[model samples]
Target: MPKTEKSSMSWLLRVIPWNTTVVLFALAVTAVLLLGVHYYMEGLISIGTLFLIYQYTQMLNDPIEMLGDQVQEFQKAKSGMLRSRELLSMRSEIEEGKEEQLPQGPLGLEFSQVHFSYNPDKPVLQDINFTIKPGERLGIIGRTGSGKSSLSRVLLRLYNLDRGTIRVGGTDITELSLQALYRRVGMVTQDVQLFDGTLRDNLTLFNSDVSDHMIKETTDRLGLSQWIDSQPQGLDTYLAAGGASLSAGEAQLFALTRVFLTEPSLVILDEPSSRLDAATEGMLQSAIDQLMKQSTGVIIAHRLATLEKVDRIMVLGDGKVLEFGAREELASNPASHYARLLITGREEELA
Candidate 1:
């Protein structure tokens, strides 16, 4: 159906009934008042009885208005349910792979001849090719919509590529089971979701197997021990849903702690410190540096300064690799995109 027509139809569906009910209510009240006045003037009813009839007419107003409100609410709920069911009934694009486990240790990652798009005509990634050696850190710099986050999505198999292969530790990711793939590859982003639960439950995601000792150890490693200690109930503290009581930085720390527990072979940081304040970014940076040391890391950042610890840098533009080389090489070359961004102080301006 045409979107405009559909929208008009929906708006009419909602507005028409309410309007009709309001019109009917007004007419009924007017008729009651007119008749009550006439009956009182003709001595068929007393003034007190006329007033009582008017009061009774007014009484219907509440329920009539309430009925209109309920009708609108019911329509909204019906539309939402249909959408939810449609989503639920859709098939997954990804086909489960046969391999059950990823290789042990920091896994090298490679992408070859990759292309992807949400729509056929507008590609988000095009012929992307790169490799990160096992245990090496790669910082990806790109403007918004430059496919930085899309790379992470494909790496985690959230979306199947239109073409080409992604290999981790020499095994094609398409051959790995979704469970095994996710277990070995992890990504942390700026937005953190915290449920209404104790700090322990939020951190462990209610997993009983994650021992208190391990949680404590990870917290200590991430330098979050002090923060946790300051909490009124420490690990036992009950957090409001959506991390309402936690600052943006603290919520990110929780996200890092959860990823740390997974002990992924490859960790991707998708602008984790973007929303953080200077002091919190420093703390997050410290935690990230420590995390990077233990796994194959991919740091996606808008600022070049964030890539200081990276071994290599990849610059992307318009879904293509604009530059990819050792960080030192790119930084020293004045003609390089990375060098130009540094000289112009436009690193943070990229996004």
Candidate 2:
């Protein structure tokens, strides 16, 4: 069947009523008008037909509503399962650092001939191709919903692109195990998600095998040591649900420490400070700068100033790579939409 036809039928099946009140009302009205119509034509009308139709409708509506309720309950159950699963999940369970594939080798990354869309014909990233050398810090700036998140997903292979190839460290990501992929990459989002556990648990992600000294060093460098000290049990104090026990900056500090403990080869941060105040953002930025000192990284930010000192900037618009080059070159060329927008976003920041 055609898509529209199927959709309409499904809607009608879902929406039509089955109750006898409507059927009886129709029957009564028809009866009242029967004499005029019967005398005008050969008589062929009955209340039984309406009654039978109403009975069938009742049968259909009962199971339809019941099935709908079941579907909703099933979704709620799935959501609950995931919530509990994350509570049990470990954010990090291993130690830091990986040696370069070769001595001073390029931790190169590439995306070739990629295409993606949430739905067909509405592609988000089109024929994308780019390469970033090892230890290169690239700033990715795009208008809201300009496929920035999709690009990240493609890099992580969250969903397969319609067509493309992606390589990390000279090996096709398709050929690499997800475990290795994650070990090679780390990320922090706008919101820091802390489990209901101790400060050390959140920092080391409950890895009993990891040394306390390593956790302490990572936390101390990220300035989480003071927060830990403030707690009654020091590193052993329970982190309330979502880290509610700690202030926003303190929670972010813990998150940075967690990432630092792993010290993945490539770090991706997506608006990690978008939700924080000036002081917390400054603290987080400082920690992040320290963390990125020797790693390949991608920072996706809305404000150009957040990425001012990064090696290169790629600006995207309407799912296409609009302008990409050195930040200085982009800053010099105001004719580009990206430069214009950066100039505008900066002005607003100042205002």
RMSD of each: 4.5, 11.7
* Residue-by-residue lDDT tens digits, candidate 2, 216-327: 7776787666667877998888777666676656666777678778877787776643456666667777777777776888877654556765888887777888777777
| Alpha-carbon runs more than 4 Å astray in model 2 | 1-106, 230-233, 241-251, 273-275, 345-351
Among all candidates shown, the one with the greatest TM-score: 1
lDDT of each: 0.86, 0.70
User: What TM-score quantifies how close candidate 1 is to the native fold?
Assistant: 0.75
Residue 224 Cα positional deviation in candidate 2, in Å, after optimal superposition: 3.8
lDDT of 1 by residue, 286-349 (tens): 8888787779999887555578889999999989999999999999999998888888886565
Give residue 84's lDDT in candidate 1 (0 to 100).
Answer: 81
Instruction: lDDT for model 2, please.
Output: 0.70
User: Highest lDDT among the candidates is held by which one?
Assistant: 1
Clashes of 1: 0
